[model samples]
Target: MIDTNQFLAQMQEVLEIEDRTLSPDEKFRELPEWSSLAYLSTIAMIDDEYNVIISAADFRELQTLGDIVRAISERQP
Candidate 1:
């Protein structure tokens, strides 16, 4: 089972977010840290941590951090 909190922490690390804690409901794209680089980093992070590869197109469709967690959870074996 993928834990949401752990996932959030990983996101914070991957996104280089340190000023504030990440919430599942937060719209990640709206964050100042969010960028093209952040998107790529997130893809790599998910692949490395969860062994799940999320394409840029699919990743772009995700609105919130919770959506990302759910996507990864659903794809995991």
Candidate 2:
């Protein structure tokens, strides 16, 4: 099972965000550091950590960190 707190921390590392903590309701795209590279890094991080492959299009549809967690949970066996 994936813990939300741990996942948030990992996302912080993957996104190279050093100054602030991520929240479940936070709109990641609104972050100042958000960019194409960050998007790709997020996809890679999800794949490596959860074994779930989320496409760029699908990823774009996700609005918040909690949305991502729910997507992964629904896709898991």
| TM-score (all chains, Cα) for each model | 0.91, 0.89
Where in model 1 is the C-alpha error above 4 Å?
A: none
Candidate number with greatest TM-score? 1
Flag clash pairs in model 1: none
lDDT on C-alpha atoms for all candidate structures? 0.89, 0.86
| Ten contiguous residues with the weakest lDDT in model 1 | 53-62
* Model 2 regions lying over 4 Å from their true place: none
Residue pairs with backbone atoms closer than 3 Å in model 2 (clashes): none
> What TM-score does candidate 2 get on C-alpha atoms?
0.89
lDDT of 1 at 55: 70
Tens digit per residue, CA lDDT, model 1, 1-77: 59999999999998887888999999998998998888888888888889999776877789999999988988896
| lDDT comparing candidate 2 with the true structure | 0.86
Give residue 46's error in model 1 in angstroms. Answer: 0.5
TM-score for predicted model 1 compared with the true structure: 0.91
